[model samples]
Target: MKTKVQAGGVSQSPVIDIQDLSLVFKTADGPVNALHEISLTVQRGDFVSFIGPSGCGKTTLLRVIADLEQPTGGRIQVNGMSPHEARLARAYGYVFQAAALYPWRTIERNVALPLEIAGIGRDEQRRRVDQFLELVELQDFKKKFPWQLSGGMQQRASIARALCVRPELLLMDEPFGALDEIVRDHLNEQLLKLWLKTNKTIVFVTHSIPEAVFLSKRIVVMSPRPGRVIDIIDTNFPTQRTLDIRETPEFIEIAHRVREGLRSGHD
Candidate 1:
């Protein structure tokens, strides 16, 4: 059911509200608890990152929010609706770890795929594809196939495709985890600029603490197996941030705290 809670004597609602959410997988090895007692509230336009080791349920939680996976117990509301309902309404966009662009399709065609499926008009599809291509600085490469572009460019195309639907929430699962440090840094800067310009609520899942620290307003640290949130560390940095800010002591301190949180979770 939809939830609207009151706080500070005022009506405050969360864009994504998860309450005691638990998911168990019926594997051959028996029941595996992917997530247990997971609760989180993501306000509108908030940039939140979930960081944890492998098998820690970070990606699983993201998938749950996207309605790709169903929760075995408890409740989850996305944009004041059930996750399935919200997904059907196109309330959010998802970017996977891999670009997953079609090798046969041109970058522009790949970006236009969703619009085409949604029965958007030809002219409108062309307009949005062009607009988002430029948004991700890939307008010049639009005509090229995915195999023709560099890894970073391909990921940028994927991001542009995700934004084409104009969803309010962007759920990314380690989109740049495989890129080299230089390329990752560049994309991180571009992503921050894009986030600032669009003001969409983004929930990113990553294993890199530095990437989490640099991109998120709040970092959700998770434990290993049962994947519970051990800590939620808020950043003091301003929204208008550049890569140079990562070198500052403040940034390092936040990274250190995230590291400590992860360590404590392991303990």
Candidate 2:
């Protein structure tokens, strides 16, 4: 779909647009506020990270974008359409905290499952599965089951599955949070490369400062329960940056700002 530029050629319509969005959960105790007056816009092909403490509604925000959860107040649009509409159109893909791959399915089968569900022909499914497995560097493991692959590799397969659909937007919720630091670092690098190659508009939820700083063009910080955006820090880092970029002074400075934003949110 083509992006629509507004009157006077000011700015293109955002890939994801949310304004004054709020969500509340009904509980035994009464009502719990999950998000409050959250407003944000994500442009096409932008890699944006949402970082916050537990219960800060970062994932809730992502869920809103994915239409997995309904908002109680305000408005949101994905790809210039309602989240529900966008969901119906399969405009986005989601990668959850866990790999969530089925043990019964081989890596290739797992990646091909979505295509099969979408009624794509067998030949197209094979083509997409092979292409995405190679994209994630897991072509060699296509025949293996989820139980046979390493945790990191399993997550890579999950990512490949998400990409096989070729959604314009990707919503990732701490996909690497469960892995060891070393593995997480490596996956982060691979994910960065994947994002660069695919140019997907990614909204990633993470608690790791360095990961957010390293991967995002913009880092959005949120408050505790009744979450509100406390800051939206722009990194503007080059797309081709390496893991070593984390050691740079500019990166350090941005990390410090993110830390401060988190601390301020708590206060």
Candidate 3:
């Protein structure tokens, strides 16, 4: 939907807009605050990374945007609609920490399952499955089961599945976190290329400073436990940068700031 701008112009509302958002979980031990007054706006095609300690609400916040978890306070709009509506509209695709692919299904079938559920025709499903698998460079692996692929390849297949839905936004929760350092770096590069190609608004959760700096256009540093945003650092590196960019002084400086922000959050 289009939105009216104040300057005699029309514009789209941010792909994701969140204001004073907070969530609490009720447990036997009492209430646990997961997020605190979180306010953020993600523009179209931006890649934003959230980084923090283990207990922070990174995944929780992502789930909130996905409408898998409800917020207790404040407001959030995904694709200019309530998260529930946005979810029903299939406004975004989520890649969780694991591949989460079914062992019984071939890679192509796993990627095509959602389309099948959505009632897409068989020919269309094959087209989308082939298209996305090629996008993720897994076209040849389509016949193999999840158990047959390497960890990194499995994650790539999961990403292809997410992209097959053709959502405008992508919510990724450490999709490469479990891979080896070399594999993680390679996937990070591939993911960057995919983001550039798709122009999808991506909100990624990561624990690595270098990964955050390397892949993000903006990095959101968060506090521990109660999960408040401590900083939002911008990166102006070329969109086509390679891992070598991480060795540059500018990248190092950004990494330092992210590190300091995490430290301040702990205090």
Would you list the C-alpha lDDT of every candidate in the order shown? 0.91, 0.91, 0.92
Clashing pairs in 1: none
lDDT (10s digit) by residue, model 2, range 1-267? 224324325246689889999999999999989999999999977899999999999999999999999999999989888999988888888999999999999999999988888899999999989999999999999999999999999999999998899998899999999999999999999999988787788999999999999999999999887889999999878778899999899999999999999998897
In candidate 3, stretches whose alpha carbon ends up further than 4 angstroms from where it belongs are 1-11
lDDT tens digits, residues 127-195, model 3?
999999999999999999999999999999999998888998999999899999999999999999999
lDDT of 3: 0.92
Q: Model 1: runs farther than 4 Å from truth?
A: 1-12
Residues 1-267 of candidate 1: C-alpha lDDT, one tens digit per residue: 113233332225688999999999999999999999999999877899999998889999999999999999989999889999989888888999999999889999999988888899999999999999999999999999999999999999999999999998899999999899999989999999999888788999999988999999999999877879999999979878888888999999999999998998897
Report the error of model 1 at residue 231, Å.
Answer: 0.1
For every candidate, C-alpha RMSD to the true structure in Å: 3.9, 2.6, 2.8
- Candidate 2: segments with Cα more than 4 A from true spot: 1-11
For candidate 3, which ten residues in a row score worst on lDDT?
1-10
